[model samples]
Target: MRFIARFCKEKSEYFEIITIYDEHNEKEEISKEHPSIKTITIKNPAGIWFERKMHDDFGIIFEDAFDNRPLVHQERFPKDIHPLRKEFTQTKIEETPYLPYKYEEIDGDGVFQVAVGPIHAGIIEPGHFQFSQAGENMLHLEVRHFYTHKGIEKMLEGKRLEDAKPIVERISGNESIAYQICYRDIYLQATKQELPLSLQKRHALLLEIERTIHHLTDVGFIPNDAGFGSALSFASKLGEEARRKMKEVTGHRFGFGAVSFENSFIDIVAFNEWLNDLDKDIDFFEDWIMDIPSLWDRFDTTGILSLKQAVKYASVGVVARASGVKIDRRENPFYLKHGFSMANEESGDVGARFKVRLKELKNSIEMMRHFLEEDETVLEVAEICDGEYQSFCESSIGELFMSIDIKDGVIERFFARDPSFMNWQAVHIMMQKDIIADFPLINKSCDLSYAGNDL
Candidate 1:
């Protein structure tokens, strides 16, 4: 195991292998089983750099990089390159696969393969899911994305700090605030700029509000898939209303041009009134969901993920929280911002996650109310600081991480990692024995945004 780790470190690149073991076992004990992972002092051990070589020749700032590790530092990221830091030049040589793709040679009857979209029913985004099933039950499910990939990382080339807002907002329309806040925070960190206190508070409150409504959608959708219509109808209605009212709070719910109450030009009073109305809606959603959980027995302990797998995949947010993996970016030591006691659940299933999200909505609504109740003068507030850094938070699905780099008054580079990249990979393992019909249910339950991931 030690030797493999050494080889991987030397051959640092994307998709390079790393060692993982049972969560209950000691590190030394796991090393004994796989004697090839080399032992060494590892810096920036939490984020991706430890997983690969340094970034391209540009500024790359990872949220998990230790102070002493230049490999993960912004300076090490190569300049004149791309997001993944992969090199691209004018002249290139390419090769094709030796053999064209072919079907699996399974030696059994009633074993079939089903290919579901890069497109699907109901206006969801594109993704290719190939399922190898025995009759109706799945034996293997492969998920391939990038259908909507528009070179977001590439499009960011030389974009000004403010210029990137449109692109950032487009990353995932549903995750507009999640992406916007991350982008702005990074730019601020790199440039040593500070957001208005009102903006900071409002951004946090809005993010939670997004999570609340987004969670409401997932909670309803998953049950709808389980053939429970009543729960779906009510939950979906709650989510729709929550989203509408949330949009009402910010003049543009999607959060375009939303800068700390939008100055004197916008009506702050109207926004507060909307938030007040949404608060009531959330209370009703919680009360109703409490009763609906008793109706579905399958949602209780279904799709259980052990702590080992959760850690291996680096799952975040509700997915990890449900399975006893407790990591929240709001609480991350590197962020150095406001601190809040995070809420979580231990049942490790659909119902339990639903419960946690509901509790979360209650907290978020309170934050919104607080912000709205305060006077607009708070927008002028500020706290200045020095040094460059990255910030992250738990979004609707999992951890959304962002990094910022500033040179003088300009942003050097910005990078982000959506939970879908990691959590989506775990679906193959989770759906190993799940039924075919249950695929959409499980997938929607995660509710990973395709647009956010396409980046």
Candidate 2:
């Protein structure tokens, strides 16, 4: 069983610990009076973060857990102040005395520590990366995030289904379409409404557009990190064109409000012309990058994540696919009908990841073309029944899982496990034995989202 997510929901007399796997789900009821349960991390290491987050939110103890350290709460946060508890209704709280965080330490004769960011020089989100190194070679890397946690899950409680769409769509700016589609799928499931085939095709097209934009950005940034600025210039040009086309088609550059029950119209002539130009430009870009031996010297075999480690960590998206794991969620008939093909690589290194993104970019372009060739029409909303519903989407990053509980026509509980949440855990594994200088390149290859993960 592949572990997916573990979360907790507060109840009047007890707390429910929900563990979700690929095939099945397990629930454990812990009395609120004594909210302690046995840890599953001994068997499934991926549960480490989940259990710790639950402890921070609901004060549910996972007894004998391998790592019981706080995952969400940082230093100076009050102890025993469970934010997600039903009784804790304050919107503001007082900070406690300074408390030092315990990061894993490595002591050796020449080993020294390098700490980077919770604040960075670039216009990016905050995340701390601590490195134990000996003369530029990284011995260990520990990543600490969640500095921008917005309490989104807690904010969703008691919100009407329609009112939650904007909030969910904005969870990650780059993944707006994916989140919207996933949320719409959950709503459809709860309301027992089947989206028209026409609308589904439109949604798929918008999704592919979003994927292409992000992949193009990554491919460009990867080369830029290697000191190849021309590739970034070319890629930025293409990405801007794609973003403009997105706005033309969906009335939003990021496709924020694109996935809905209403119909969306597209001009086939202009859209097809843009796609054709993009396809040719991408081909040229890929060939140009591949022929640059200097770039390959920096990319090839740098920051390797072995297949064994990938599976052990349950890595997803490009991280898993580049390591030869066939784990994409877009294998359904709809995608296949639209000429979808999974890209794979066995090297598990920077070059392999770059190539995978190139191939996926081409595949997404083709898929969008196929989807646009088909006819589409409008859809209508269905009556929503109050209950639980779950949905998944193959977002640009990887599989995005969302689950929600509806009670009295409003959201009672909402949980989302973004691809970044899974992929970020495996980055430290990739950094092992790599040089500190190449950290920027390897990290750009992964291109994780802090907002999505922090939420």
Candidate 3:
């Protein structure tokens, strides 16, 4: 919060924190010694329940912006609230009652619906979408998420920033760096401390490596989903091979280093060496994917999302670029302000996104090759500041926005908005015009990580 507080504005003038938690059923006012902070509680809907209970008082609490206050709608904090609440035992909130059987009725000659996911024979998590269709065309689609909502945001409340790294990383395992990149910037804003100059370069380099790997994994999946699985096999192997070398470099499989505060860590030369090998593997994979005409034929004109909707929904990175919206963080010229050109395609289809990711992977290889050849002094930090600041970055997926509030060198407030949340809606939009059989195919092509959205 401190980082967010400081970064948002002057920490003293504009600091706000709001929180809500379920407790006992009593609607009692808690202590508010800090006049600046406001606390609101409806009631904690938990513990000794009445013989019969209705779901009237159960809902989410809205946070007040001026002061960090928690407003609870429930009459009591449910024992089911935070699984980690100290006084009450923890249990999965999933057991709580929910209305799931609602159905809409219609009288028509030949209306049909296709219920997809929540369980499919794919290496993907669960999601269910009921699409009311008329033969090959779709009338409406209702998406049923929460299949992977682990309440991670709620879990991070009141916890220290360092402790939240693992949680953030786990929020979406595949896009670990996007989360960590936002997480690190927010942490710095909260603490008002800059890391060593060498470390910042190291972070950027490592992040690019992660970006390369993530793109490979997902891009490879597109072909696999299209039954052009061979395009992905070698690419997936190279990606995994890249990860293994990165693990040897950072001592962690996913490149999660001393994240929050500085701590003693592992090798650097090894990272440089592995980066070179990664380039070769990527080149090999790229060549293999290109030779397969089946993949391109299926993907080329499929799932068209135009530029207007892409920006309207704030789509990020390759997804937006594939649709002809050219916005890349490296070109922002704010922080680091490196001279990098954006890779764009006006095709607005699965193939466009594929080409964009492929170009980005190439860019990563070039960027790393340049950085690795630099001397130790070249990447060294000459400037570090002590102040709160807001950081907005574009991830491989989309815009990664974060605010850090720092006070007394500790995080006071931290907030993050990932690109997946913004781009997730676009999937539904693009899928609308696509064929019934092409629905799953379109979704897999624009595979916006639902785990990223759940946060």
Best by lDDT: 2
Model 2 over residues 221-264: C-alpha lDDT tens digits?
A: 99999999999999999999999989998888988878887766
Consecutive 10-residue window with the lowest summed lDDT within model 2: 373-382
* Model 1 lDDT tens row, 1-455: 11111112111232222333212211221121222323232421223332322222222322333332322112323333433432443232233334322423343688888988867997799887888889877888766666675656546644666677777777887777788777666655654556766656667767866777787777677777778777678767767776666666676756655533232333457756666766787677667756764444766665555677666666677777777776776664422334355667776566666666666666666655554434354433233233334666567776776654444534444556677766776667677666787787677766788777656
lDDT of 3 at 240: 88
Residue-level lDDT for 8 in candidate 2:
90
- Residue 287 of model 1: what lDDT? 74
Order of models, best TM-score first:
2, 3, 1
Model 1 per-residue lDDT at 305? 57
Each prediction's Cα RMSD?
9.1, 1.2, 9.6
Off by over 4 Å in 3: 1-98, 101-108, 258-288, 332-339, 373-389, 404-414
**lDDT, candidate 3, 1-455, per-residue tens:** 00101111112333223221112111222222222222222221110010001011111122343211111212233433423222323444333343243333233678886777778777787776777777787766655554665545446644555666777766676667667777777665554556765555556666777777788887778887788766677778878877885676457778664233333343557765666777777787778777878777877777888887676555676788899987776774423343356889998898888888888888877666544433242222222333444566566676666654444444444445556655655666776666776776677666677776555
Number of the top candidate by TM-score? 2
